[model samples]
Target: MRGLNKVTLIGNLGKDPEVQVLEGNVAVAKFSLATAETYRDKSGQPHTSTDWHSIVLWRGLAELAQAYLRKGSLIYLEGKLKARHYDDAAGVRHYVTEVVGEQLLLLDKKTGDALPPAT
Candidate 1:
């Protein structure tokens, strides 16, 4: 039996996607997404929680995100969790977990009065 490591999230981008090219000209996009959840507590009071997730997209997906996505853009991402460790300049080892996005969907709706797509 094989275990699964899948994550699905619908959230809004907290900032614009940062695209970087590696040594081999491979493109990588990194950004932060905020997911908000609202619910009622035991006391019948409303509570809202927002979780920020680090999202990473590679290659073609990265290019797509860089071209269309922007701050506050709503998106649906599906990916797996990846943990990376590295040593900072202060010689401190840091561990970061992020969602390595394999699939991305743009959920923003275009208004009728919006400008037409550039030719």
Candidate 2:
């Protein structure tokens, strides 16, 4: 049997994307996104909860992120979920989950912002 690992999120960026060029001049960008959900309890009081997600973009997407994305920008992204573990200097193990974005849409574009390059 085959399996799938996909995620789609619509949220606001928590901060500007941090871009780094890896060995071989491959660009990578990392940032956090905040998604909020509103729900009502039995008493009818509404509450909102926000979840933060780590997002990563590679190559062209990374370049686009650096050029266009900013804190509080609203976007829609589609990607795959990746989970990894690493050991810190103290030998303590840590786990992280991230979304490797393959497609992105800028939802809060204003009249003056620069547009992405044409295909």
Q: Relative to the true structure, how large is the alpha-carbon lDDT of every model?
A: 0.89, 0.92
Q: Which portions of model 1 miss their true places by more than 4 Å?
A: 111-119
Error of 2 at 6 (Å): 0.9
The sequence of per-residue lDDT tens digits that candidate 2 reaches over residues 1-119 is: 99999898999999999999999999999999999999999999999999999999999999989988999999889999999999999999999999999999888857477555321
Best by lDDT: 2
CA shift at 64, candidate 1, in angstroms?
0.4
Residue-pair clash count for candidate 1: 0
User: What value of lDDT does candidate 2 attain over all alpha carbons?
Assistant: 0.92
Global Cα RMSD, each model: 4.2, 1.9
